[model samples]
Every structure is written in C-alpha cells, then in structure tokens.
Target: MPLPLYLLAVAVFAMGTSEFMLAGLLPDIAADLGVTVGSAGLLTSAFAAGMVVGAPLMAGLARNRPGRSSLAAFLLVFLAAHVLGAVTGSFPVLVASRVVAALSNAGFLAVALTTAVPLVPADRRGRALAVLLSGTTAAMVAGVPAGAALGTILGWRATFWAVVVLCLPAVVGILGGIPAQPAPRGPAGGPALRTELAQLRRVRLVLVMLLGALVNAATFGGLTFLAPVVTGTAGLDQWWVPAVLVIFGVGSFAGVSIAGRLSDRRPGLVLAVGGPALLIGWLALAVLAGEPVALLVLVFVQGLLSFALGGTLITRVLYEAAGAPTMAGSYATAALNVGAVVGPLIAAATLGVVAGHRGPLWAGAALVAVALLVALPCRQVFASRSGVPTGPAR
Candidate 1:
C-alpha cells in the first residue's frame, strides 16, 4: 500500500495496456501498414517472444543494479519504443518497436515483482503482488477497452502515444517515490547469478513456477480465442463481445482482491479448492461453447477461479524461491510468458481442425488437468513452505 507500490502499479498499467490493446488495434494496424491482418497479428507474437527472452536476461543483467534506476531506465526505453512505433510508417520498424517495448516491459515486470515483495511485510507479500498485478487486471477492464475506443476515434497510433504519455508519470515516480537503497530482501546484494540459479533447483520452486505456467497456459489460451467463441459460436452480436470481456475482467479483479486478502494465510486451501474448480470450469466451457447463456455465465466464473489460482501460485513462487532473490522475479515472469506463447499455439492447433470454436476451451481444460496432476503429489511441497521468510533471503 506504499506510494512506491502504487507507482509501480501505474507503470504496470501502462505496460499492460500496450500488451493487450493490440487485440483491438490489429485490423487498423494492418490496414495502415498495408499488410494482412494476419501479419499484423504477428506483432502480438513478437511481443510475447520478446518477453520470454527478456525476462530472465534483463533480470539477470540488472540483478545487482539500483532498483529505482533500473526501473526508470526500463520505463524510458518502453516510452521511446512506443513513440517510435507510433510514428513509423514501415511495418518492420513497428514490429521492431513492439519487440523493444516488450523487452522493456519484461524487464520492468521482472524487477517489479522482486521489488514489490520487499516493500511490505513477509506476511503481506501476496497483498503486495496483488497491488502490482491489479494494474494488469485493471488494464483488462479499462485500459485495453479504452485503447480500442481511442483507436476507433483517433487511430491506433493514438493508443501507442497514450501508453507513452501514461508511462511518463511512472518514470518520475520511480525517480522520486521509490528509494535508491534496496529493501530488506532486495536483490542489490543478493547472490551471484549462478548462485541464484541454484535456488531454482529447489523442487518446490520449480513445481510452483511450472504450475504457474500451466495455469496461465489454460487461461490465456482460452482468453486468446474467447472473442471468436462469443460471436461465432455463441451466436452473440459483435457488440456483446466487449460486455462479456468486461464481465470477465470484473471477475478477474475480484479474484485478485480475494487472493490478496487470503493467499498469505490460506494459499494451500485456495490451491486445493480453486485449482480443481478451474479445471472443471474450463471443461464445462469446452462442452458448452455453443450455449450463449452458459458462455455468458461461465466466462466470469472462469476468470475468478483461474486468477485466484494464479495468485496463489505466484505467492508460492516467492516463498519457495526464498533462496533466489536475484532470479526469482524472472522465474515468475518467464513462466507466464512461456504460457502466453504456448497456450495460443495449443488452442490454435485445435481450432477448426478438432474442436472448432471449442478448441481453446478444450486446450485450457487439458492444460489445467495437467497442472492438477503435477500438483497432486506436490501437496507435500506446500505443506513445507507456508509464507515468505521474514529473515534474510534464504
């Protein structure tokens, strides 16, 4: 709840907006750049690819740097990339800009995750993560939709400009609000990268992050193809898509709120209850994509369960990775981006060829089912570590 945490959230909001708003701007981008819409869609893939590569690389490179300075530099690069993308007439240049922006976004997120945990009490680490991640959910509910609307009125370039403008205050806040000195568990004085990577071999940390990847694979895979399911399969009007997405967003926000309050105390309980419920929810969606009423109701419920599970896994990552302060954030960031890339590929492969509109739902269900299987024996792992360590890192 500190000002620094909120400032980090503000920066995350801008980055999250840039990440998801392209969903709505793709057609316009393709038209303006004289490329096929399918080609412009590659920009999204480029961003995810950048994130996957950047998260660990950037986090490792800046592991011992001043947090505030690192954050400011990342924000500056992100803003500059957006500016370049907005003005560029060449699609290749625009793609390059997206890649650059994604790298900046990944670095900021990797550092921010580690930065947030130390800003609060050990017991409140989950809450701190929620505060930072709320920016992402808020982007889904407001920023992405708003960007799409702006694109409608002012063109896609405006959305890029908006991201640049929005990030300016965050750069200032990083330079001012956040302290130059590291937090108690800060990575500034943490072990070398080799030693940090050793902590990743901790079985619990490995399992938790792997679970995070699978959970996100399910959710992101389903979400990436949801708009089509809504309009094409569920027989809804195009206008209804936004409303359905908003419902999901509202549920996602609620999920994160609940996780913030409960994850620190009852993460095991959440993982036990919510994880299976998420799998069931995805399975149900896979079976009922054609039923509009079912689709409408389930989307919100799915969002709630998926993200509740997500937050718990993230907390577990922090707790289990207690020995790896330097690389912990990158570990979490890479898992999510890995899922972001793999999920859609799984869903897209199933689309039309296998499950038609229901492919993504099936893909999601399969991923969660695998996650549950992975977690079944890992109950012992959760039993071992319950909260973030209050003492030194590991």
Candidate 2:
C-alpha cells in the first residue's frame, strides 16, 4: 500500500480511539458532571447515532470535493470537537462534542476508504482496506487501554486532550502525504446521486449490506457485555478483564491480517468459514461460560472470526457496489454502526430473560447463524467473478 494509505490508517486509529475511549471514561464523566452513569452512557450512543446519520449525509455533500481535501476537512472538524470535549464542563456540551466528533470520524473513514482503494490495484483492494481497518484493531489493542489509563491518572478530560494531540500527526500526514484525487463520477460524467441510489438497489449489494449488519450485531451483542461474562461467570478477578480484552484485540489484528490475504481470492470462502466459526464460538461460550480457560480461548477465537468475517463482508459489499464506491463505503459505515447500536440493545434485553452471562452468547449465536444463512447465495457470485473488473453493475 502507499504511504498515503498508511496516513489514512493513522487518522482512523485516532478517530477509533476517540470512539471507544468513552466506554472506559463513562464513570468518571458521570462523577464529574453530576449525572447518572446511565446518562453518561448516552454519549456512546450519541456518537454511534451520529455515525449512522453522518455517513451518507457527509459522503453525499462531499461527493464533488477532492478526497484529500475532504479527509483533511473532516479531521479538522474532529480535532475541534475533541478540543471542545476536553474543555467543556457542561454535560450537554460534552455529548454534543461526541456527536460532532463521530460525524467527522464517519465522514473521514468513508472518504478515506474511497481514497485508499484506488491507490492500489483492484485485486489488492481487500488488503488495502485491511491495512486501513487495522488502525481500528490497533486502537482496540493499544489506544483505548492507554486512554483509560490516562483518564485514571489525569481525569477524563485528559483522555480527550490526548486524543487531540494524537490528531496532530494524522492531520499533518493527511495534508502532506495524500495527493489530490478528483471525486468519483458516474458514467454520464457528473456526480449522480440517483445512479448511486439505483446501484444500491441491487439484490446482491443489499444482501452484502445486511450481512455486514448481522455479523457486527453478533460480535457486539456478545462483546458489549464481555466484562460481566469474564468476572461474573468465569469467576475471574476484575483485573483480568483487561488481559482478556487484550487477547481478543490481538486475535482481531491477526484475523484481519489473514482475511486480507484471502479476501481478494476467496471472499466467499472466507465468509463461509468465518460466519459458521463465529456461530460455533458464541455457542461454545454460552455453554462453557463457567470455565475460565474455555472462556478465554473462545473469546480469542470469537474475536478472530468476527473480524475475519467483517473483512469478507466489506470486500463483498465493495465488489457488489463498485459503481458507487463513495456511497457504498458510506453505507457500509452506517450499516455497521446500526448493528453496533442494535446488538447491545438485543443483548441487554436478553439478559433479563436468559440466565446469567450466557444470554449474550446465545443471542450472538443466533445472529451469526442468521448471517450465515444470508451469506449462502453469495458464494457463487464471488467464485464466478474472481478477477473480473468490479465496475458498476450493468
């Protein structure tokens, strides 16, 4: 991949850290702002909601802008939002800042994905996306934990300040590293919103989007409540939670690395293997939640399957929606966040009816099973078009 792609990855890492760091800081934020912890949790939801709304909106608005310029602009907005968050004392202001930051983050990622793919050959697009998305996995492994530690030492505000500082290098990289590339246009030689929408109407493309949502829902549904599963069910010490999370994060990184290599040549096969693996992992977790050793091993495997499945789903979407790369990329962002939001809700609801921490695992298993079924038809599609040009579908 090109240096500009790595630069884009850096920006993604910074934004992803900001997105996930809030989970660790919620208690501190509640204490400082004199709000309930549940209320403070709304900040995470607000950020997700912003992403769901902003992805398509921002991509549409910037459809005619240069990709480099758009990325830089989004990063600037993100930086400003982090600054506002760090300095603000009012709870509403903090929430607003999160929404603004998420909007910018979503816009940056959509534009960045669109920009990064064209920088390499068509066959390498899957690997290129993996390089960009590895930033998010890196954030999970290093950035979120580091931000939490910083928040513990210097207060929650300091975490946001740290994010602001992190943004500087990404900004410089975006400005200096990326060359100006004209925004993509339709065959008629202009930005075609109608054409993009029409491209999204295809059955295969819609199925890929649905698959993305379902797989993410499965992953997050179980993961959102993983701390409880570790401490409550597995009988591990609270401190062990971090270690388990680190294992999962490392596994995620590994999974993405492997998936990137295979997705170009065998995307459908990756999905076929990964989706069922995820289902089995979740089922195993549900059945063996009481065994710490089993729980630990399953979590790592689950993380691997989750991310590998993610890479496959995204590659499929990009292939199916090649006619509308920018819009398709934006929609992928929105779909994933939509799943992120819904997954936790489903898991939370199941917790009341199902026994113990097994609830989330069972819920996740069901979601992944559905996703596997949905992905069945796409195998032939991928096999038939292995090296074919993924231009706009006729």
Q: Which candidate leads in lDDT?
A: 1
How well is each residue in 20-51 modelled by candidate 1, as lDDT tens digits? 77766666788898996546656776787788
Please give the TM-score that candidate 2 achieves against the real structure.
Answer: 0.90
lDDT at 359, model 2: 87
> Could you give candidate 2's per-residue lDDT for residues 1-394 as a string of tens digits?
7888789889989997888776456667888999965466567667877888888898888777788888889999999999999998999999899899989988988777777766778888789889998998888788877776777678889989999999999999988988766555544534378778788778877877888888888777776667667777898875566567777777888888877888888876777677777888999989998999998899889888898888777777777777776677787888787777677667767776746667878999999888877667656765643443433211
List the global CA lDDT of all models. 0.81, 0.79
- Residue pairs clashing in model 2 are none
Which stretches in model 1 have alpha-carbon errors above 4 Å? 26-41, 89-92, 182-188, 388-394
Residue 295's lDDT within candidate 1 is 89
Worst 10 residues of 2 by lDDT: 385-394
